[model samples]
Target: MTEKTAGKSLGVVGLAVFLSAALGYPVLIVAGRGLNPADGAVFLAFWGVVFGIGSALSPIEQEVSRLSAHADLRGGRVGPTALRTVAVAVIAVGVLGAVLALPPVAERIYSADDISLGLIALASSVAFALQFGTRGVLIGFREVKPYGGLLVTEAGVRILLLCALLVLGVTGLLPISVSVALGSFAFLPFLVKARKHVDFVGDAEPWSVVARRTLLLMLSAGLTASVLTGYPAVAKFFAAKEDLDALGSLFFALSLARVPLLLLSPVQAMAVPTVVRLLQDEDGHRRLVSLLIRGTLAAFVLAGLGGLAGWLIGPWGVRLLFGDQHVVAGWAVAGLVWSSVLLGAVLLLAAVLVARKQPGRVLLTWAVVAAMSVLVLAFTPGDMVLRSVFGLVVAPTVGVFVALGLVVRAGSRDTSVTG
Candidate 1:
């Protein structure tokens, strides 16, 4: 019965992850097929900023909900006071994003046309916050199926609209931006579903404690999320117009390489709740150690298999999907695939850390990674496009090491105590 319950839970999570990734993978393929290289660069760049904002808000969304649900299960709740705090935090972030999207600031991040679309995309960040916040509530309430459905609906709307635009020959940043904004609202229906979950976190910890923790996590983990989503834009800024096509092609390859993340993202929603629950039990640490080890192994295996697949057909894929200008070197594709494997491991490790209530380690990991990436972009003298791509490949190794160290330390700590 225990094994069966675990299996059923695994099956449900697996379904959600794959289903969430469905539209995303296809969207990348369709965009590659339809958009010109330069436009692809614009689209990818705009995507970085918008999604970065969304990712930034995700800590609040996922944590608040997970905590809310966890509290409820423990005879506590987040309550009206904390919920209001969440609201205030959302508004504050939204304002900041809006200000950053203004003309002067926008120019720093994008071309004039791209800036226009970037602003529109930024507008969608509010919707993103609302959607994710609600999702956290649903997650906390253990409405897993509904939570997963909302995930699919949000992504589905964007991809369907993008496909329609592609069919009509509207392959540019504007179409992409509009699709993002529209799709963000697709989760409105789920907000109501989450209402009961958010009603009152009974006997929960102090709102101040949760608020402080949420803010800290948002700053640390959010920064990492921002870098992952925003690097393409930053890379584009460093690249000359002559190099746009190459950057675009590299990004196209990156999108495919990161297909694993798309699959793992929703699956990770279960991580916090599961880890938190497990950690409270007598065998919590052992269970967490086992899960982390196996998950990391699985991530590495997938990386190897995915890398081999990429090496074989990656160049052919680029040419077929995005024309000859999009040809990626086989070695580069292989490196990126392995890097993605590292990335998946990093994400898993991050969840482990989060579950253990240690976000500082996650921040340290990203700080090192972000510094390396920025230095490479700013000072690595070479073809701008090539250098940026190299940085992307190298940065994940740092995460791998840091995550490995934490895993070992955690295991040792648990063993010393248990033994």
Candidate 2:
């Protein structure tokens, strides 16, 4: 893509993200209020299910699109049946995992708050999966407008629906669950509209090849999800039951801190297909990589500055946005915010790996982070100080180091074409 085109794409993505973030804060405050200490655990558990399933399915979508584009560019064809079948299987696994995991865990490990949040998670996972699947197709085609529109639509609808539900006294677990499910399916209309702009239909390919590729994608996606979401979940696991409230508060703070990173997700989203296409041309690939790194660095620096500001004024911000009840989470929020800055930088490395189709390297890097996260949590004392120290400070710093190492190693590898 031309620099001008890329700049336009970036601008669109940034606008979409900023809009989502602006809308998200109020919605999160409302949602967070609906969550009590008991409900928080269930919410986290539910989130775990959502993340697990969503993660597993993500790679399938990414790989399918990547492979499909590769095939198309090389004058080859991919069977639509093969693609749809793999997608169906992925959906099946995700649905099954959510159903099984949510019910049992909610009954056993979760508090009342967790129970409600868990239900919402279960419902939302389906939506998350579908949105992600469609997004992959859009990215593969380098359709930035639809991709940005879809995100804006999802976030906007979810917020509106959540507000409407709250007004209707449907703020309980069951209602929240229904709302989540509705939100997940709400993108169908948009996807349907966007579908006409791209082609995903064709004859079926052999099931064996489809199945194998899908499985690899699933594994890679799952590992990536685990690394991303597992940190908070693991922190909760290490925390005491009575201290669940504080932990939940910390998780909320962390989520808030991640807002900036979440807003910039569209950058990475747009980068994937662009980078993939550029890989075919040596100079283009280098330029694309350089642009992505520079953008990532700039984003990280901004997030860090935001984090510093949050540290200085986080309590006031928390009080103003989420109310005084949640103000105790301020310090944790500040710490987690800075941590997100580090993690955002790490995503650049991840984007590079994705562009290169080096899922194995991505998997290995996350595995190391996961191991270190577990080790840190295991050794830390069960207190707010320890949790904050480990979860906020140590874990993210270690992940940044690991991500940097991967980026360096990836940089060192020969970039010659191999097909």
Candidate 3:
């Protein structure tokens, strides 16, 4: 089992690095164009929405699947039904956002948008939410090749579209946003084709029961999203009030630092179903949990080494990727990477909790973290970099450690009960 798990982990890791390179390079190029501090903030805000919605929807889908399984609904039908519901909700939100109420909200959040960025953000949000929910179905079915392929293809198409727009001198948030929506559209056919392989197209269970469970799951998932994406926005609040240049540097550093986490995502993706199955058997659960803790610790040590290397060589990398003018963002980049390692560990714990059906606990932990982040950002002063590092990194790191301890204790209690 260990050997098989290791082999699977290696394969997923390889796929992650491949996709990241394919996707990351183009994103870096697009990001390079936004050297202005305001542009940097906008870019971060766009991703904040995209990833925030994605993260928020993740565990909701998990809950949907769990409920569907319990109710004996077909896998194929369960996903499509939930996705259709979310897709409609997303579109409704977009349409409602067209009102003047949005600009004020954007302004309050320091995310001033021309009509184009707003519309683009709106469209991107719906597309992202739909794609994410469907992708969850694919993962639940264990259709990994198609799942990974869709991701790589989506990233490829996005890059192509973005590059085409840039070459035409139509570089702004609108075109990129449209490109994101289009890229999402490109994945629909693949999802349709993938759905044929899974049994997801039959009659679903009762909608009322499913809706009730999904809402609870949404709250949990939404809180997780807050920690992942809300932290950046919270940091942005403090960032905007301080030195703009420092804010830009922090954003750039943090963005670059996230690449390693992206590279590690496939591991977590595969880990989820694997852990879920392991938890069904007593000895298997114990073995799986032990391995996960050890594996996460090992990954962290490696990430720490990589972060140190980035700290040492990051300025040169930044210069090469962005420009010599942006070299000073390296230290923050290194710090951000180290923070991601911490975040990655927290994520692994979250996944374990989900597998154990304890997502509410995970949600509560994120609530505390998000609240702490807001407080720290609101109170901190001095350079934006220092403020951001403290609020986003220091506070979350503390929260994650506390969350990890709780999860470990919970797992132990669960084992005792089952034993």
Candidate 4:
């Protein structure tokens, strides 16, 4: 992909992500108003699982596209082997979701009474995993427009269905759960043309090589995602019922913080394909460095603006939208906004590292950050909200420095390599 096309693809995908959020945020707002504080917490806790599951499984889509994109750059066809491999990864994620919902394991993460929601969450998860793989193929093919369409299809379907359900006076967990599970099936239409492919066994890259990369990215994606969405689960497990409302606020703000990060994720994901293709140019590493500097500046500028907005308006907005009863800790919102800012930088760094075939650098960054997240959560003693704020704030502070060091190292290494 040329630099011009790369910028355009990033814009299109990022806009689609924003539009999806616009369509879906109303449902969340209505739920916050309609449900009582306690029920809203319960609802959010389950809703968190739905999204968290999707986040965990997204590596298959990313890695599939990454591998296929390299092949495309090399003037080779993306074989069915990549597709078939992604299918297994999707299935494995489904099984992992199921296993986590089992009695003993489930007890550790979520309340057992949520078992029915857990089961429904599993179905939603599988559907989303499948959806992600299909979308991944489009990305690998560099089918940017179609990729944006698939994103719209699911979120659009959910909004329409959810609106209908609200009009029918259906409220509570059932509507949200049902809408999400069904919305994920919108990925079906995009998959129709993806299936009719013959494997070029002669041109086939070894599955093990592809699988190794896939596995590495999968673990990296999963860990990075856990750092993003796993906190609600931690709060669900360890936080007292009295602390649930504050946890609810944390989750809600985290979801808001997620918007820019999720929007940024597609841009980051596109980098592996786009940047690798750019490496063929004589000034490739220069182009790569320029991309990194631009991306970092863009990410920070947006994050700073977002944090400023959140600091100014987030508390009032949270209550107004979700409900007066829903707790909104102003500082927590600020902290989360900045945390997500740091996360955006981490994501861009990871994408560049992956494009450089330095997934290990990205992997180590996430491992250390994930550990920081865990340690802060485990050792802290205070109000749940303060603990959450502290943990969320501190980990990402650690992340930004770690990410910067690795990014610089990778850039220096690439300079030597290309020279």
Say which candidate scores most in lDDT.
Answer: 4
What's the TM-score of every candidate structure? 0.82, 0.75, 0.77, 0.82
List the lowest-lDDT window of 10 residues for candidate 2: 410-419
lDDT of each candidate versus the true structure: 0.71, 0.60, 0.61, 0.72
Q: State the lDDT of candidate 4 residue by residue for 35-110, as single tens digits.
A: 6665566666666677766777777776667767777687766676676666666666678778867876565454
Pairs clashing within candidate 4: none
Sorted by lDDT (best first), the order is 4, 1, 3, 2
The C-alpha stretches of model 4 lying farther than 4 A from their native spots are 1-14, 66-78, 139-146, 198-211, 262-309, 410-419
lDDT of 1 at 124: 80
Cand. 1 TM to true fold? 0.82
- Candidate 1 regions exceeding 4 Å error are 1-10, 70-78, 167-169, 200-211, 262-309, 323-325, 407-419
Name the 10 consecutive residues with the lowest summed lDDT in model 3.
410-419
TM-score of 4: 0.82
Candidate 3 lDDT at 331 equals: 59
As a whole number from 0 to 100, the lDDT of residue 186 in candidate 4 is 83
For residue 268, give model 3's deviation from the true position in Å. 2.2
Higher-ranked by TM-score: 3 or 4: 4
